[model samples]
Target: MAEKRTDRALDRTELIKQTTLELAQELGFTKLSIEAVAARAGVGKHTIYRRWPSKGALFLDALLPADAQALDIPNTGDIEADLRTQTYAAVDLLGRPPFGPLYQALLGEAQHDPSVAAALNERFIGPQAQRVRARLKLAQRQGQVAPELDLDLAFAILSGPLYFQFLIAQEIVTHGYIDRVFSALFAGMRPSP
Candidate 1:
């Protein structure tokens, strides 16, 4: 009997998470409310609060995939090639409208809500940022990048232009743009005199 109750609880949580994500995708995170999420999930508002104390916590939980795929960064032994691969992947992600809107909403909310910002930074940004840092370290080890290159700055250089083009300029991130950025970054960071 106890096991059955636990199973039901798990099922309810999964249902709520799925419903919240679907609603967030359809209606922008800024417009999502606990009452609406509860209605869509077919669960009571109290039930959601019991699982997560606040809407931000619940939203973060829903944002994460239950079977999230791990990113596989290629180590082609050519640092510039690997950086280009990573940057292109980021461009692809930013170009998708559904996800793009969701991210924009979250970022905007994060500006006002520290708790939500912390959760977003911890769960979403931190891991991806670490991946980029690791890739930079690998390049340094391979003697492809300058020994004194500031990795944080390198990351900015690799991703900043792409974000500007996609999010600000409202331009499509193309292969040519990625190639141009890669060329510029390599020119600056390549082993120098």
Candidate 2:
């Protein structure tokens, strides 16, 4: 009996997350509401509230995968190749429908909502940044990156232009632009002779 109850609860939670994703795709994040999610999922508002404190939190949970490797930078024995591979993958993720638009909407909302901002940073941005920094540190030790380079600054330099094009310019991140950014960044990051 207890096993059945646990299965039911897990099923309900999955339902809630799937319903939230569907609604976010249809309505976008700005218009997504907890009430609507609960109604759509056929659960009480309190059920969702028990699971997630805010719409942003719930949306974020629904948006990202539990598999951390989805965003991990591969060690290909070449730092530039690895970075480019990861950047291309990231651009592909942000360029697709539902994912791209919904993520963009949440990013826009985070600008004005501290809770949302904190949640985004805590769950998504911070973890991703940490992974990038770790990859850079590995490259530094491998003699691919300059030993004296600041990992945090290196991360910002690599990601900043992509974010500018992604969020500010609201333009699709082209392969050409990505190549240019890497070319310039690698020029500076390469170990001195």
| TM-scores, all models, native as reference | 0.87, 0.92
Candidate 1: tens digits of C-alpha lDDT, residues 22-131: 88888878788999999988889999999887777777777655356535568888877776787677667767866666666666677778887888777767777788
Regions of candidate 2 where Cα sits further than 4 Å from its true position: none
Q: Looking at model 2, which ten-residue stretch has the lowest summed lDDT?
A: 63-72
Candidate 1 accuracy as TM-score: 0.87
> What CA root-mean-square deviation does each model show from the true structure?
2.2, 1.6
lDDT, candidate 2, 1-193, per-residue tens: 9999999998998899899999998887778999999998899999999988888778777877455445778899899999899999999989998788888888887887788798788778898899889889999999998999999999999999999999999999988899999999999999999
| Top-TM-score structure, candidate number | 2
How does model 1 fare in lDDT? 0.79
Worst 10 residues of 1 by lDDT: 63-72
Score candidate 2 by lDDT. Answer: 0.88
